[model samples]
Target: MAEEPMHSLARRFVDAWNSRDTAGLDALFHPDFRWHIAVTDHGDPEMRPLNSRLLHGMNLPWGKAIYNKKETIDIFSGIFAASEQFSLDLRTVIASGDRAALELVGDAVNPANGRRYDNLYCYVLHERDGQLVLLREYQDTLLLFDVWVAQ
Candidate 1:
């Protein structure tokens, strides 16, 4: 199979994210896809997000996982639904044959929590059969906890 250009995939990703378009996001991924979010290392035990138990008992240097495409879509859909406003500001992106790396600033207001969820994210994507098959994301998990997890 031929490799897809990372720039094109990156653009579609950004567009889909900015618009909270779950279908568009779905179209960009392979049937078997995984989304991993980096665990913050402040020398503290991680309290898994109550809404997503997908990471239960799993911990890897790469991050925590959401097993497949459907779950990924479900989690993202929840985020979109709960947010009063959400968007990503792209900072930089670099791509090679079947891999792409992205840097972005996330801005969102979770009305449920009434807190602004602003974060810096770095994502590494791996493509298979021209669709994204794996993604490992790095971000400030502490901010994530404070905004969405802590009471």
Candidate 2:
């Protein structure tokens, strides 16, 4: 077996996310991939699984009831971290043989209460034969839920 380059894989992940390609996102995951995260829920610890990660990530219904969203940020680095861009940060990225991980932080300010939510999100990836096989993601549900309040 051989190792695939990490930067290339990173590019693919970002490409999928920026394009909002659901299938492309799924293409990056390994079948056995698992995602985990610890979040605060009413002062209690809350954990999410792979299936839930994907399901919850499908995006809120854009049909009606909308709120303000921060601009899309994409962080990239070339020539080995010579430059840093906060807006486009990969969220957070970790890549190794047969495995890769990322955290996409989605933050916003609630107009109703003027509260800000900067959540630490992450995506766990697994691959085989140079192709993605499994993927899972984790994010702060409370932070996001706080922004999209129902009237």
lDDT of candidate 2 vs native? Answer: 0.47
Models 1 onward score TM values of: 0.78, 0.45
RMSD of every prediction: 7.0, 12.0
Off by over 4 Å in 1: 1-4, 40-64
Candidate 1 residue pairs in clash (backbone atoms < 3 Å): none
lDDT of 1 by residue, 1-151 (tens): 6534887787788899899899999999899887766453322235344445764443332233444789788878977887857899888889888899999999997677789988999988888887888777888876786777666
Q: How accurate is candidate 1 locally (lDDT)?
A: 0.77
Error of 1 at 74 (Å): 0.5
Residue 58 of model 1 has an lDDT of 39
Model 1 residue 100 CA deviation in Å: 1.0
